[model samples]
Target: MTITETSDGSITIVALCGTIDSSTAPELHKSPAIADTLRSVVIDLEKVDFLDSSGLGALVGTLRLKQEAKAAVLLSCMNPRVRKVFDITGTVKLFHIFDDTSAAVEYAATHNEG
Candidate 1:
């Protein structure tokens, strides 16, 4: 997977492409910039084709770390298959999920403003 980050002060948007699995999840989870400076993280998954247990675990782990830092994490643009995996694993309610990047960014902006 490839991760590209864009930050506008308080929120950081991380656009992800390709599959997120056991091999790629570690790199994503260990991003120092994202782990440290981001008050909120928006993960854009529009180009993701697949995800496994490790991928979901990575997201959950990141969310937990963000929460520990008193921040938030949002997920966006999940395909039907990925969404189904989240639903099946009952992680859907654990995250702030959106249908598109704009909505996730908007949510982050609004939350930051508040």
Candidate 2:
């Protein structure tokens, strides 16, 4: 799995690519960069091809962390398969999802500004 982070003052976008499974979930969960950021987190899943239960757990854990910090975390650009998984698991309702990078950024900006 690959994770990239970009921030524009008020929001932090974390773009994820490749598969997120049991083998790689720990690495993502332990990222200090993600843990330390207080701004809202927008997870871009456009390039992610596969996700397993471990990945789902990691996401849920991350969401909990964000809640604890009083920060927002959004999931964006999820492909059909990924979206299906989230839907079946009823996790889609737990996050604010966007269709693209621009939309996610705009949503974050507007929410943060208000």
Candidate 3:
């Protein structure tokens, strides 16, 4: 996976491309700038085509981790199949989800502290 970031004040937008599976989950967890300390985080999964159990685990862990540090995690553009995984596992309710990155970014900006 290729993870690119865009910074808007304290809100960090992480755009993830390619598949998020077991092999990539660890990489995402250890990504340089996507720390749990950020006050606002928008994880753009628009380009992510697939997300497996491990991938879901990583995301769940991220939300919890960031929240512990007083950060809010928002997910954006989860494709239907990948989204189904979240829905099936009841993890969809755990995050603030949006249909696109723009909304996520906007929401984070308004609701979070820089």
Local distance difference test scores for all models:
0.83, 0.83, 0.83
Tell me each candidate's TM-score.
Answer: 0.89, 0.89, 0.90
Query: Any runs in candidate 1 off by more than 4 Å, and if so which?
Result: 112-114
lDDT of 2 at 48: 94
- lDDT string for model 1 (15-110, tens) is 889999999998886665566734688888888899999999988988887777767789998889889899999998888899978778878877
Q: List the residue pairs that clash in candidate 3.
A: none
The reply for model 2, stretches above 4 Å from the true place, is 112-114
Evaluated at residue 41, the lDDT of candidate 2 is 77
Please report, as a residue range, the 10-residue window in candidate 1 with the lowest summed lDDT: 30-39
Q: After superposition, how far is residue 98 of candidate 3 from its true place, in Å?
A: 0.4
- Stronger candidate by TM-score (2 vs 3): 3
